[model samples]
Target chain A: MITLNDLTQISETEWEIPQSFRSDMRGPVRIFATRELLDHVLTDKSLEQAVNATTLPGLVGAVTVMPDMHQGYGFPIGGVAATEFPQGVISPGAIGYDINCGVRLLGSQIDFETAKPHLDILATRLNQYCPSGVGKDGMVKVSIPELDQVLRDGTKWALKNGYATKADLARTEEGGAFKGADPRKVSERAKKRGKSQIGSLGAGNHFVEVDLVQDVFDEEAASIMGLKKGHLAVQIHTGSRGLGHQVCTDYVREFQSAVRRYDIQLPDRELVCAPMDSPEGAAYLGAMRSAANFAFVNRQLLAHAARRAFEETFAGKTKNWHLHQVYDITHNMGKIEVHEIQGERIKVCVHRKGATRAFGPGAPGLPPEYQKIGQPVLVPGSMGTSSWVLVGTEDSMMRSFGSSCHGAGRMMSRSKAKKKFHGDMLRLELGDRGIHIRAGSMKGLAEEAPDAYKDVNAVVETVSQAGIARKVARLKPLAVIKG
Target chain B: MPFEEISHTADWSIRVWADDLRGLLAESAQGMWMLTGTEQAEGPRVSREISLEAYDAESLLVVFLEELLYLSEFEKIVFDGFSDLVIEGEKISGIMEGSALRSMEKEIKAVTFHNLAIHESERGLEVEIVFDV
Candidate 1:
């Protein structure tokens, strides 16, 4: 087994395992972390996994691991890579099981000071309105064709069903739909899994929380996002659910053979991939995009459900509680983006696992209002901690493929956390802090306790220090809804 | 051996290993099939080429198994194992042959890292992997 002594420190924040260290590696593996974070990463095979990601076919740049990197199935969580378009392989493992597992932030009209009185009631209503937990079904029942449309159209389908509006779509990432998603590429089983999960939140680390925009770092950027100090917002984190999981599982195998057929060599099986131009690769992309679209619809419908919850909670209030979409970004996804690699503009399939797309201001893909401040990067912390609102930087576009850290990466395992903390104690602790939590299961709550994860402040500081992303605001949780 | 009545979730995982890269890969596939309850369908084998590359050995295992799942879903292939395991760096190239996946076939939806472990133990080499089916 490789030991910690094998690594050579490049910078205070970067660690490198050179290509000479392993003959199977196509390129070098670079990790961004402090010495303390590196100690935790070394406890598992995460560093080894990052090295394995370097073996992907036609990898153009060095494999990168973000500060929040953790051990995952194939590639380490928070890993990023770019492969040659059409020639580089796309492994489902690289994108992860949850296809578009992402975060969405909504800026509300009311301030936290005004909403504080109803915080407890709103948390309960949100948990009740949004279906969650294992084997949960969406509030909307869909037929086969309608479900296919949902898979194909994403948030646009929500607009058709009167679940969303044009403004909502405009505020979403990629306008709430990714192009080139063909539902025909999706399987029957995948379809079935997605049918009932369109507007539902699946269990295991998924959450919807009420947050207060506690601080703002950039007045101009914050103004564009309609953010003010003490204002309330909603952050929802989830993904494509079983449909995306099945899609990834189905494609990793297809590319396994394709990699051999193409005669490429690598160090890890989990990093298996086929050339992007190959039939197998194209099929996986099509299916992945479909899954991504499904996730977009899933989140949109969930927002619709959240709106309904508010409507029910305050039926005869002064004004309807509308949660306007601020931004939506998928952490686990591969997007075809053009970036300057060594001063040449090249198209690359940027695979971000447990990372967010932090396209800088004036980037082509962002919405009109956000063009000047860059894409709003929603980084949700562990329950009862502070999250962040970051904007992409030109430095990110030039240096790290317009990517930034996702959240307060896990430091402790679920079992370890469960053994150390009790659900009752955690509930009381959060309650003592005036943070109301409505969780489906107390056992689940204990697993996601704040201590189970690293500090969000440190994680954000790393990215800001790296200059890939700039902090815009810090959001503190008032209430949390865990599935 | 082909699996039978195997049921594993992303939450509950197992890791198996062998000396050669191919042997390790075949056993991993075998373990996964067993977890998915696919042992009951002892059908004719179909030859298919499977290849993958990772920066390390563990990630290679993950990609290899994911490929097995993909082939089973699309091509109806339920591979028992790989024969010629040749691994260099993170890339593992091998020949896999398995039965086709039918309606009655057990399917493993996804691979997870809930309780995953990989190491060289008394039983040659062993790995602990989780499946989310």
Candidate 2:
């Protein structure tokens, strides 16, 4: 078990576990956290997993973990690692089962006061329109052929099908579609699972919250992103659903032999991987990109549903009730990019599981309007708490592989949360605080109580102080819809 | 039940033990059902045959449980009984019997191989499985 005593404090918000700390580690582990947050992380296996991640072949620099880090199956949540492109291994577990699990923010022009009277109706309508919960099919059903198109075209398919607009695509990552997506690489079982779940918010910590932009930290950046103080915004958090889960499962299982064939040894079986140049790796990359595209389209469809809900609640009453696309960013993903490491420009595949890409100003691939400010990094807080909007900094690109924390990571187990808090009572509490709640299951709601997670403000402060990301605005939840 | 839930900071984990591989597999399935709080409908019981191949016992166990999860999520079927089970070099075949799933309180995203090992214990065989939810 790793403890605080084993770490070397690099700074007030930085620590390191030297490679020599463990014989199997190929590199050091750099952690970004405050002293108090480090105490929370030491209680779990998160640091151990970070050290284990250093064993991967072709690793560049140290494995960096965010302050919100928590113990996960293989790679700890809020972890980031980069491997040499086309040569380094790509572990399915590193990218996570929910491929491209991310957050989408849509800013509205309507003020919170104008939309106040209809908040309850808006929450119900959003819940009614957006399909959520376990084993629930989406509102949009596509044929197998259409599903393949979604895998290939992503939000472009949504555009063709009237589910999205050009502006929406421009604000999404990779234009809401990743290149090199091959449907043939996806299993038939995965295709079947994805065919009916195009626009669903699956269970387990996924939600769509209606937030009010309460504070703007950077007026220029917030203005560029169309975020106005006192206005309403919507955040949709989900992923590739069952399809992505099946894809990861199939690849993780197949890679069990790939590891043996390649003669690669790992401390854990879940960390199994294959060289990016190998046939198995190529297949997984293609299939994983396809799943990611499915997720992009999934969020687009949900945004469309959310727009309808907004229109239903404030269309005739308010002149401009439209929810414009602010930004869509994926937390769980593997992207090939070039970065300078030790004064050498190297191309590497960055694997981020529960970490957000925080590209700095003037970075390529960002929309023109955002290039001056930087990419929008959405950090959604737990239910009925404050969510943050941040921007990437040049320091992020040089120090942390252009990555930052994802959310207020879980501080307590689900069972513990359920045992400590009553679902019904928690709902009432939120209601008394004027935050409307619509949940499919009270037990599920209890599992995600705000007290179960770390403080979002503290997480944002850590990342900002570490110079990986800069704060733009803070949002307060007015209503929530959980699966 | 020979399996019980264990404390995990995030996700779910369960420890199971039995006298043999077959018993271990059956009990693991039961434990998974318990973790999800799966309830069956008041209908006629259904039975189906299942066959799987893997690189090892750990992989076989994951495949077996994943098969059940797939069925439960996509087909709304839950299996609680196993019979005529056989395990060969890298394959397993058995009959699974259960009823339609009426409701499930939780969703198990995937069965992970995080430190998964089936080994001999003083009692018999034992393993701990972590699930991603």
Candidate 3:
């Protein structure tokens, strides 16, 4: 029932719903969107949900919604909230059901000219070599015991199994492992569900795309990320799969009671949470970390799959197919991070659902190679559009708690998009533009039509102009595999 | 009754409501099962007993529904309806029967708390839930 009038425009890109709007609100709600995009926000209950998020207990700052914000159960997607450490409550809704759903970018030395003739074969090989579609299984099935180790060790397990290289780990966020993961906290059922689906590319919006670096804005940053104009790159968007979903599902109900026990008053029931120090919170955190770890390992496995596909297509010709990991980042997650809050450094659990971590230069978490520059921000565009590669900026730390927008952001609903556009027509249109499309379902395909999303180029322009992330390179899709 | 779709931006969700606590729970299970197209699920029948504790009526409702989702996806049991339900000191204990865990004909994936509510109204105990797809 909340209306757009409840929000005050802070800037062209920033909107705010102050704490006085509701009695239960502990903070304000901040949204990032253009006037055109606000229409989508107004069409649903997403803006209201964003306002409700301001009521979460121990919320330190405004409940921030990224430009890609949309209605989600509990917290809106592209939402970010930093609650005071041990005292603040951790809500699964804030972290999202797709725990650690994220993207990883691999830059290559080869250019489109070198890869163009073999593009068809390479696309077909990728489709064959990589197991995709819904409920698909891979060749590498681990035993129950081995799976448990993976839950605990994440990408380390993949590295140990020869599925990932040291360089892959070096370029990944947190080196592809969240140290707090405890497999014991993950339920037996979650374990079994994850066993068969470790390397799978599950259905619905998940994709593997081969792209060409179409433009480069910052020469130094582009060089650091190993991007050169016209070079080929790969992007994989997925997550912890069944394990993460189960973990979030398990905790949402758990935190419901925990919220009541603690007498936490929330404007929305979906924002149910408990103090981070409590047993329930600890349990959820442990389980969430395990799932995040699973996602990291899952991507590592998929990367290995991509590598094999390239090798099979090229035939011992890796010199031109030198795919190096640019960066891997999680968009939906809750991490215990130390940040300067009102001049004092305090540890806090930052829940970022559908938002990316844009750590500035000199951040401790960055790898040695990136410390001098900043974290590599991977922003995947809509299918057949331009995706971006950017580096975090110092201003991001002061402005957005070292976070930025995740994607181009949806401007239309699936049903509306399907009604407006035909999947067959879209495939033809994209094909004419030189982008290849392979999918499990055209119905699902129409749901993600590029026309349904905002121009990613514009989104990148906002973040770059706003000084949150410095644009490095822009990538145009060559081929896409969706499930 | 059929499972109903609810609005969720980043994910998908659904809801089911009933009068009594037992019926409310049964309908929630039914809604989730229907969402997953359980009638279409190809698997053998399996049975399991569930016990859950909560501090309040609303949380109890959530826990009850979550247990059903967990059982369906994990244990592969599609419990029809529980025979008995007893509420004591914020705890609800019941027995459910269903089918073996197998590939889901449709992936309901996860249940979410979006717009979740449990209350005693003119219709008795009214409950609503959202599922994350």
- Top candidate by DockQ: 2
Q: Model 1 scores what on Cα lDDT?
A: 0.78
Across A1-483, the per-residue lDDT of candidate 3 in tens digits comes to: 666687798878778888998887888887777766776778777777777887778888777777767777667777888888898888888888788999999988887887887878888877776677655765478888998888889899998889998989999998998998888888887787789788988877788999999999888888888889988899999998888887887777667667778998876777889888999988888899899999999988888988887777665544677678999999999988887777888787888988899998999888887888899999999999999988888987776778888998776766567678887888899989988888776766787899888788877776776678888888999999886
Cα lDDT of candidate 2 equals: 0.94
Each candidate: RMSD: 7.8, 0.7, 3.2
The parts of candidate 3 lying over 4 Å away from their true place are A1-4, A316-318, A418-425, B1-3, B15-106, B118-127
Candidate 1 lDDT over A306-397, as tens digits, reads 88776665556636467788888899999898888887988889999998999998999788898888899999999999999999999888
User: Candidate order by lDDT, highest to lowest?
Assistant: 2, 3, 1
- CA lDDT, every model vs. true structure: 0.78, 0.94, 0.79
Q: Can you tell me the CAPRI class of model 3? A: acceptable
Interface RMSD, model 2, angstroms: 0.7
* Pairs with backbone N, CA or C atoms under 3 Å apart (clashes), candidate 3: A71-B9, A203-A483, A204-A483, B46-B98, B46-B99, B76-B101, B78-B98, B78-B99, B79-B97
Candidate 2 residues A354-413, lDDT tens each?
A: 999999999999999999999999999999899999999999999899999999999999
Interface root-mean-square deviation for each candidate?
Answer: 8.1, 0.7, 2.8
lDDT of 1 at A384: 92
What is the Å distance of residue A170 in model 1 from its true position?
Answer: 1.4
Can you give the TM-score per candidate against the true fold?
Answer: 0.82, 0.99, 0.90
Chain B alone, candidate 1, TM-score of 0.76
Better candidate number, 1 or 2, judged by TM-score: 2
